[model samples]
Target: MAEATAHSIDQDDFTHVVKGIRYPPVVTEANLEAMLNFDIRDDDIVIAAYPKSGTNWMLEIVTKILSAGGRTDASSDDMVGKLEFQYPDEPRPHHVMLQECASPRVILTHLTPDTAPPGIAHPQNNVKVIVVMRNPKDTAVSYFHFLEKIKFQTGQKRFPSWDEFFQLFMSGKYNFGCYFDHILGWWQRRDDPHFLFLKYENMKQDLPKAVKTVAAFLQVKLDDASIETIAHACTFSSMKASLDNSRYRGRAVNARKGIVGDWKTMFTDEQSRLLDSKCKTKLEGTGLQFNFE
Candidate 1:
């Protein structure tokens, strides 16, 4: 593998990729203004993360923690279906879903800080927000596989090659803007009373404690037994199996192999060094850390 050249990043409005799933469009100042003016429920629970950063995993854990016995009734299928980020034209509007759901509605977004719905993530807002952090190297690797497993337009089955994808990823032109910038925006608010930050690697190291931490932030009281039930149900294997057998089978191809450090094999020495430099510079003095092991 060779060190790749930097590529131009595209900032298109709401592009569609991988089976009609829509990535939110470029967040112009006007767009952010609109979101700020929008109405949001006070009891809203927002989950934010870059793509392939254990978003779905966190969703399952948070959902199970809230629902006794680690499960909710079938009536919640509409709410459950709306948990992942959808295209701008998704049949149901995110705001509408929030309005329709019962109090303490849970919604997810892959948007950056500035672009976040104003009522949801404002510095003064006390809305509960869970932001999952992960090593961008691993995230990039997982996201690449996701793009491939998701059929592309023009009838192509796979995406641009790994080297090509890596360059585009480094340029911050791929999905959720620059990965570093997105995290930094949220990191600034870690001290906010309503925000909770969890590391992906730390969760892998100790799932029980991780689940408990999430529960505490959400103020969901669970005894030792309930915590254990949720931890078991949210295990990567259990969640993946559940998705496979459910209505989300093909739609969830990108949710496979919830492991860390795939970048070790996937990244060329040059690419690894480049990512390390970028991560180090962006994360310096921010006190955020990731375990690539």
Candidate 2:
């Protein structure tokens, strides 16, 4: 989500999150083991999403909504792990890190429910987890550009072409396994009081309404004026023009074309058809749908 995306591309050359774990879960076995053992806190807010699904954007929006005066910097102070590689010599265990975060911490992760840290996934943890998703077509396009950028940086081999990558994506053989599985795992938890699901396309189309919805979920009260400020701050144009966009020279910077239906330009006729067929079959009976248009 808001974690380092390119680093994985370089480390395994796009085969895995670390050495052993594959996509969907997208964490090394050691990382998963450490996460399973991590203790949960009574009050924590967790944001879960696949990479390039507007994790950073949602983080900014939720933080500002929580900020009484519409402040934007509150998220930066969130103690959730940055989702980076934990060095062997690291002094603190993963559980210790969670325990040390300031009160009411906001955590972020791309891991699906089965593999999520025990603390966040615990049945009685009482943490609020917000899951954001985008159409797979756009997610694939954004993921492609992100991998392409990372390849250049690491001098790792490119994925050959968009056509091949599409096939890989269909099979969920990419860095994260089947996109459908990632979405489905969380979709099953829709009824859980700890989970909140939102679509990126919906947020992009009606931001003020989305912000209002977020405020309610977080139990934060904000006036109409504050809502206006947050909606403006989270706009694609506003986020693209901000100085922080340039902080990373990778895909985070290319987040410029963060519009819906970007697949129109990137996917071929056959590719589009394949994705349509696969999605229909895989997502069938799940009641989960994506707005490709």
Error of 2 at 117 (Å): 1.2
Give the alpha-carbon lDDT of every model: 0.69, 0.70
Give the C-alpha lDDT of model 1.
0.69
TM-score computed on alpha carbons, candidate 2: 0.83
Worst lDDT window (10 residues) for model 2?
A: 1-10
Error of 1 at 131 (Å): 0.4
Candidate 2 lDDT over residue span 1-293, tens digit each: 22233222333433444332364222345666677666556767788887778777787787777665343345533534434223344565434565666656667777777778765655465678889999999999988877776666556664447776776677666665668888888888889877888999999889999999888888788889889898998887777665244433432455557899999989989888988998889888888888987
C-alpha root-mean-square deviation, each candidate: 5.4, 5.1
